[model samples]
Target: MVYQETVAAIKQLVRDGVVPGVNYAFIDQKDVTRGLFGAEQLIPGYEPLKPNQLYDVASLTKVVGTTNVILQLITEKRLALTDKVSDFLPEWQDQRVTIRHLLTHTSGITGYIPHRDKLSAAQLHDALLTMHVGENFEVKMVYSDVNFIFLGWIAEAILGQPIQTLIQKRVLDPLRMTHSTFQPEDPTRCVPTEVSPTRGLIRGVVHDPKAFVLKNHCGSAGLFSTLDDLIRFEQAMLFNTGQPIATHWLTELTRDQTPLGKQWRSLAWALLPTQLPVAHNCIWHSGYTGTFLVLDQTTQQGMVFLSNRVHPHAPNEAFLARRNAIINTYLAEKTVSSKTE
Candidate 1:
């Protein structure tokens, strides 16, 4: 009965066919509650959603994988927020862009690569390095996958290992997130995302086009995780388990790091706005594959919602609106509960 409103909203989404199903978890310092609702696959065969199913987890990779690796490096003093992109990647021509800009999404590196999905991995890498800054650089918050793509490269450059490997060793292993992985070995264990024209049903592989092109080499996306693993990951962050990253750096990761403070963004997570004058103590991020994670530092609570909203087809504006409503309902309920306690 806890999170009753949120549970109703999720069930409504399933009934409306907004998403095939959702696997979600609510976790705090001591306890976790998880639920699986609906089917994982609707076309090939009717399959009930089950625990331990891996989700593509699209942009959540930025925070769950790439951002954590960057944070660990920074904590070890191997990297700095002030370090320029040009410092690590010699091909990056934008001297004005810093690690801080990329983490906070203020880099303004907004060049559009024509037929970007068609580009080869090496070609995509080349195009990203040549991207120039936008006019709003550092003045506006434009969330771009390009920022984390570059961060992944920078982390690799500093560590001399692939981004996936870095993420595995630095984050997944440390957090004991056994169910989280880049490319799942068994397709059956993975939840399908979109029915891509070129790739058929996007199952075990990543759903993001650029990430698919770059494979595990690119870090903007391409992570496969489960609700249980994500709960562990969130608990580690919310409770400061202090294995993958230090407590000081975790504090920095959750705090707003926007240069001008015009738009609130933590190191890699977005700070959710509340009605209160002060911002909410929650840092959250969403994946394009209908997955999202929210962690409330002050309350030591976290929520992970994973759904394949894009499965069989892409989502519409209505799906997005309803998804936001579901999240907001959870936040509102939490807020009310906090006041009563």
Candidate 2:
């Protein structure tokens, strides 16, 4: 199969020091193709990557975890897109930020805040509220972790529970995503990320500094998951017409909400680059730890590629180019097959 060949390419890439390891799965709505290649750890010792191993999926938490929870709350009438930040937390009442703005990353909130060292997880929400809203707040889309940071807090405030609990009860449990979670119970089954100067050889624990400081569960980042669980998530997202989330809302969530050329963003999903094969109807997102997800609503197809590209140290710029090349390879094959049929 083409996926096998692509998986081989990934294996070769790992062998050639392009990355430490890769655990990938692709869903075409009918069946799944998954593979694990290279050593999960290569510094102190060599350990084979396993099919069920979890990875710190970093910012993917925005879509697969946080977005799922927000969508469910919206569906249940517990939250509205128009709900203002001031409504949930009193400090930001005049900020004029909405739930929709946060999801779409159009709130002009700073992309990141360096408060992890100073504030405890419990204090992040208030600290976030006090952060300066950019001058052009809500005027243009700027991808921001702060956006989902607040959303996580808003969900907690409304549900009267922690974000992790809500994710477990509402999102992961129902989908039977047994291995997907914020704080993984088993550290051994997860692939190691960066060997940070401060943290040393990181494994199982989240790689995002902000999330690590937030007790291993945060809105913007901090989720560990396997390819199987992620495939289940892609299936639900593509075929949720009558499932846990309503069809209408799912459609709205994936469809472009931002103005054209303004960094196309759906409710939470970013529009696929039109230059990519079959991406016109696609939405995708990636994690900071070299993980990526792409779904084509037109064909009910999706791909998840997870990697520990920053094993010994953080990457400077090449990881994204490598990621896109692999994704484009898969999509290119799919495109060719489509034309012949």
For lDDT, the strongest prediction is: 1
**What C-alpha lDDT do the candidate models reach, one value each?**
0.85, 0.78
Candidate 1 lDDT over 1-341, as tens digits, reads: 28999999999999998899999888745778888899998866778998879999999999888988998788789999999999998998879999999999999987778998889999988988888998979999999998998899988888788898889988998788988899789999999887877888878988888888888688889889988888888888888774467787666655679899758798989987664224556788998889899888777777899999898888644678888898899888877766666
Count the clashes in each prediction: 0, 0
TM-score of each: 0.96, 0.91
Write the residue-wise lDDT of candidate 2 on 1-341 in tens digits: 35655676787788778788888877765877777778788877888777778888888888877788888888889999888887987877565778888888877765355645667766775677777667656668888887887888788889888776777787788889888877777788889988887788999898887788765346888888888888888888777632456678666755777643366789878876543344465788998888889987666778888888888779636777777778778877666655665
Against the true structure, candidate 1 reaches a TM-score of 0.96
Worst 10 residues of 1 by lDDT: 273-282
